[model samples]
Target chain A: MKKIVTIAREFGSGGRYIGKLAAEKLGYKFYDKELIMLMSKESGLSDEFIEEAGEKITNSMLFNVAMGGVYLNPGYNNTLMPLSDKLFVVQSNIIKRIAEEGPCVIVGRCADYSLKERGDCLNVFIHCPDEQKAERATKIYNMPEKNIEKEIKRRNKARSSHYYYYTGLDWGSPSNYDIVLNSGSLGADMCADIIADIAKNC
Target chain B: MKKIVTIAREFGSGGRYIGKLAAEKLGYKFYDKELIMLMSKESGLSDEFIEEAGEKITNSMLFNVAMGGVYLNPGYNNTLMPLSDKLFVVQSNIIKRIAEEGPCVIVGRCADYSLKERGDCLNVFIHCPDEQKAERATKIYNMPEKNIEKEIKRRNKARSSHYYYYTGLDWGSPSNYDIVLNSGSLGADMCADIIADIAKNC
Candidate 1:
């Protein structure tokens, strides 16, 4: 049986690179930025719009507080809301279809929650220490050394909040995932190797 | 800085053994079954009583239904309840003291949630496929093959529900844990070795 593997990762954790390698090694289709393009093509939405809204929630913390509660109804009422919510649903449908097609690796975009009902899905989260993430941002991404930590924290917060708005579950929690790994010591290739092994067996 | 490593695992996953090895590798104190004894001494609870109630909640699925709602009060009201909750608090205090003493590897008993406030803590969950778990039970523990699957499922359910009742969190969610690994593929030693490396650096 084909197994769907979804990876949620910290920024600069090499999750995209690892997912790509795992897909290649397992002879499975890989989705990352390509998922954005796919969603754009399927939903007739602009790629730029989808990309910007992908990691944002319907409301900010300030908006939630102003509303007198931290809770926002997730039900679709057909009223005009943020494009991100629409994009999320579109991509969720796309993800479900992809999983039905065959085994594949999906990186981020809350693919795990999208396919939560599928028994064949294996959700994985990849993370690393802040120092390593900061170093990667500085060395690989050419981010300003002084701002690396800030950028890393900002991106992680965005991802966490985005996931929470959609799933009502804590991001990176083990109960929300089948497998969680720290790439701080293993690096991308080694991490992918382990994931690929599990994917094969699963 | 001293780091505390807490491992939560499936029943037959050899978490305790791996914890011992990791503790030895890092020259840290190892707590497994020994934790029960320590808790008994500190809280004046009997070891056998703590052991039996350790990985259990107030009730199983039946309790969830009878509670009128899925949620139950986690607060203490000065009324008598399950010994498991008391044992949990006792162990939590002991685990905190051990962590404050120095670096150590504590296995099971919701140690991850107990030490969650510590910035120096690394939480890990170890798991494997059912077949692998069954095989390990038969080979390592010399259990009869017929009951392996049933035993595995029952124990995991107890652990999961216990964790939920006490911490109100899923037992193995990556968001609640720092690292998760499949012992089916790597076995205990390799998992411990990888964990020790992280613990040493962390």
Candidate 2:
């Protein structure tokens, strides 16, 4: 009732699915890859750029401080430096844009830290066991078991970095979230239903 | 199935109630006050002394250097201490005993941190909105509105202190928990059912 529900999820954890279902059940708008599209349309940024940067943390004082806050001149053929750097800028705007649109479920891309300024937002982290994630990732993404492990490790590390970069807090800490659910054990449908129920009751 | 579950919750969040329900639904024994009673019996410590010093933390160098290096002294009394300190010791031993007895749902007294070394333990934090907690305190504890504020603050502060003192992590942080539930909106019974289903499936 008084909070916007934001879902932070691990890769292949059915985060987007649960977010969509909960939003639909609660009659709230859902934002995921769609958020990147919206951000692209609004900011005149490319979908590719938006996607790479969205839901990530890029601005590290460590980087700026390390480089002595100096700008490098005439870098050639730098199509991508570190997507993480540009991620915070794009996703921060996207988060604000999504939150401004009204009460909705925004999936991952660091929306939790993005909308922390809003007192009415309820941040949640959705995760399942690693085995579940690996299985799901292998099926959905058509990746090998090793690839799933790599994907999970890489994405989880990225999100954790983004969280630490933006909020100066660990990504999965219960303290940062209003609710944390295990989709592996609960199933995505039940997780969504439970979340929707919580949203309605709130 | 591989891990134990740890619960650190607000005073009136019906932490014990939900924990017991989860254990029962799973056919696992529930350890609440019984844990302390058992530890008291096993450790030759009094109920009163164990409860007081068990949950509190000591900042000695033993725990600081290394976890295995740190030796926990769960005796009745050694020197100057507050009531919280006594509670910490008793609860700590109870947590260890329960974990040794095999997996069980242990509530409050910082059971989560106490059993952190016991591999495969799931840590959970349960919280509700301030308004709901105050209401529960008033209804269950028979306290007035003004008194409710103080009591809630005192208890939450105590939990926070007890948690931070031991974990080296901020209490209530989203990163610190596997799941954090806000039972305020859904109320206690519904909250219990949802968690029960989650645990079963999880």
In terms of DockQ, the best-performing candidate is 2
Cα distance off (Å), candidate 1, residue A182: 0.7
TM-scores, one per candidate: 0.57, 0.62
Task: Tell me the interface RMSD of every candidate, in Å.
Answer: 5.2, 3.9
Name the weakest run of 10 consecutive residues (lDDT summed) in model 1 chain A: A64-73
* Location of the lowest summed lDDT over 10 successive residues in candidate 2 chain B: B63-72
Q: What tens digits encode model 2's per-residue C-alpha lDDT throughout A1-202? A: 6447899888878988998999988888888877778767865656875675565435656654543342323243544434344445556887897688788988877777777788777677888777888998888878877667777888888878867876788787655676788777557887788788767665
Top candidate on TM-score is: 2
Error of 2 at A59 (Å): 3.7
Local accuracy of candidate 1 as per-residue lDDT tens digits, A1-202 = 3388899999988788889999998899998888889899997777876787677555654543443433222565545544555667789999999888888999998998999888777678898878888888888888888767887898899899889989899897655665688787556777787677667655
In angstroms, give how far residue B92 of model 2 lies from its true place. 11
Among these predictions, the greatest lDDT belongs to 1
